[model samples]
Target: MGTPTPPPSAAKIRRTSSSGGSGSIILEKYQLGRLLGRGSFAKVYLARLLDNPSAPEVAIKVIDKAATVDAAMEPRIVREVSAMRRLHHHSNILTLHEVMATKTKIYLVMELAPGGELFAKLARSRRFSESTARRYFHQLISALRFCHQNGVFHRDIKPQNLLLDQNGLLKITDFGLSALSEQKIDGLVRTACGTPAYTAPEVISRKGYDAEKADAWSCGVLLYVFLVGSLPFDDGNLSNMYRAMHRRAFEFPDFVSKSAKIVIYRLLDPNPNTRLSLDELIKLSWFKKSFSQENLRSQGSDENPTGSEFLDSKQFKFMPRVNAFDLISMSSGLDLSGLFEEETTSSKEIRFTSKMEVAEIEEKVSKAGLEFQYRVERRKGGAMRLVKGRAVVVVEIWGVAPELWLVELRLVDGAAELGESQWGELRLGIGAIMAQ
Candidate 1:
């Protein structure tokens, strides 16, 4: 490690007083402290468990329910919960100890990694020596193998999402984009999602892509960055970058070793069919160097340790009060040729704020659909799917704040049947009902 990046300083960390009662107590348990990180809809705080002197400090991820609903990040949260719960057995995977919720917020109690994000470390160090990089890469591959063996696919794998503990052990975090085997339709995942630079070509193509192959491509990108200190396909233009990835346009620096070059080449192959699987990659000579069973076992036992007692205590129940919604707008009429087609041009989305209660909003939407002679069917998570002839629409209600709600109506399918004028009429009809 060169010129280590210091941990988040006191000046940067904001203090948040845990609401209600006195003296920064949350749910009569943990005491909130410095803010670890902040994002568009959430903030992470460092906290300590009350009355448990031996217990370690934890990171409390505080998500504003209203903000999440506004950003359509409900599905991402649900996927994270599901993925973490399933994959937390591995030592290299971040542990989600417990979950809590209030009327306005959702809390995820997670294991603390004081070293912070791996990306931050790489940024300061510029690049790692071959042995150092290989060690980290081994841990990543091991954790990823464990995930795949358990039928989980971490769709997003990058330095930013990887964390490091105080001992410098790598831990994979952020399962917001992960996909479970059960989510597969006809033995393939069709969702075209992930960081543009790291995403596989097949995924960008919108054709059904194998989850394992997509992940391998991302791993290749990460490996190149570890030794080269830069992205393989670095371009200002999104189209040019994507084109480079599709054509396997990248070269290794002269400093990269021969064995590392071979591994990277096999992994970065544009054709998914020819890409090396995680199992095959692990057996490569470069990966096998300085690697042993002892290196992996050094972290600790594989047995699941008993989790926080409070997480299981009867006094507390982890139920997410905020409803999770799928943000990805599915379009059957999408053109497969374009990798970055603008959804604004095809997807009709409308949002309005109201003082009405959730039930009142639901009723008004139903009444509006009835006026338009559209058959309304209730979908999971309180969404209404309306169909009439070949026109299809989805209406959803989200609570943004106390006494205020956001009503959203999106035209998801059959855009051809619902022309611009008809879609406008549908939106206006709903608006009229709510106005009453």
Candidate 2:
């Protein structure tokens, strides 16, 4: 960890007051402190939960329904919530602690990343050394890998949307532009969204492009920006910039290492099909210098890394009932519950929606070393049972809301063998398999 980067001097951290019953100005549950940040659609404030004074302060996103000019934007807000919730608990992604909506507005309670955007930090230091850039790049890749695993793609992967916590951890924020991997037809998305400079060639082509590869291309641009303090294909003329991006026109300063340049070249490949996949990118000599194959191999083990035994005395909490839209966006990420969901009477489970065919999911699960018995339960709904020694895991995947499959996981093991560490490791394992 390095010196904590200070936030922007112009951040509007003002004290806001609301009406109270006794003519005083104070909100009900949260004490709104300052304006932490803002966007076109909403504003974020630094606030604390009234009941839990000792709890960490949060960044509350205020989205007023009346602020929008059209009724259609509400669905996009819903989509943002759905996308954020689906990515819950990812280390490199911002966490949505709570979602509260009133008739007039929706309030989202989120974890605060006080260190501000990586862009601001870059501005202060001019540019990061290769080691520093490598560290942040690793987090960016990991977060993007997790998103891709869950079938989510952050179409906008710019520095402005990337924030750093006090401890120097990078948190990927702003899901308004995120989309489910299967939302497109034949894995080709028609919309050309994202900042013009960082946009992938295929996306600019408008003929349709793979969202996953588009994300990879953005990552390439990000790494380049991090290492070199400027845009690779930047130009005053929009046509020239677009032309440069399509032709993969970018140069490395003499200071950039050969290994890093190789990774960037593969990532910025004009053809999405030839773009280096996450698995391939991670194995690069330069990138792997930061994170190695040893840790990757260790994540698949059933044992905890720590020597202590895992005591699962507390039952795990199930998520609140979700609307149909959220249920669909989360199907891929929820496969992780088999590793972490605590044991209880009423099925300890996690539910998400998946676009992958049942046959495809089943094939992946089987290849992961688990044996299962697939059963048909009513129309468009089915269940799979897997048993190991005496430990049994039940998975139910049902079709809902047009081709979407609702996936539910239940653990039936009376004796809990895995704890937080083990479960986290298991999530990495499952995520890797799903990314394939």
TM-scores, each model vs. reference: 0.65, 0.66
Candidate 1 structure quality by residue, lDDT tens digits, 36-146: 888998889987766673567788888777788789887788778767754544557887765555556667778788999999999998998899899888888877876
Question: Please, what are the lDDT tens digits per residue for candidate 2 over residues 270-316?
Answer: 88888987667766788867564233221233321211101111112
Specify the poorest-scoring 10-residue window by lDDT in model 2. 306-315
Query: lDDT per model, in order?
Result: 0.69, 0.61
Pairs with backbone N, CA or C atoms under 3 Å apart (clashes), candidate 1: none
For candidate 1, the TM-score is 0.65
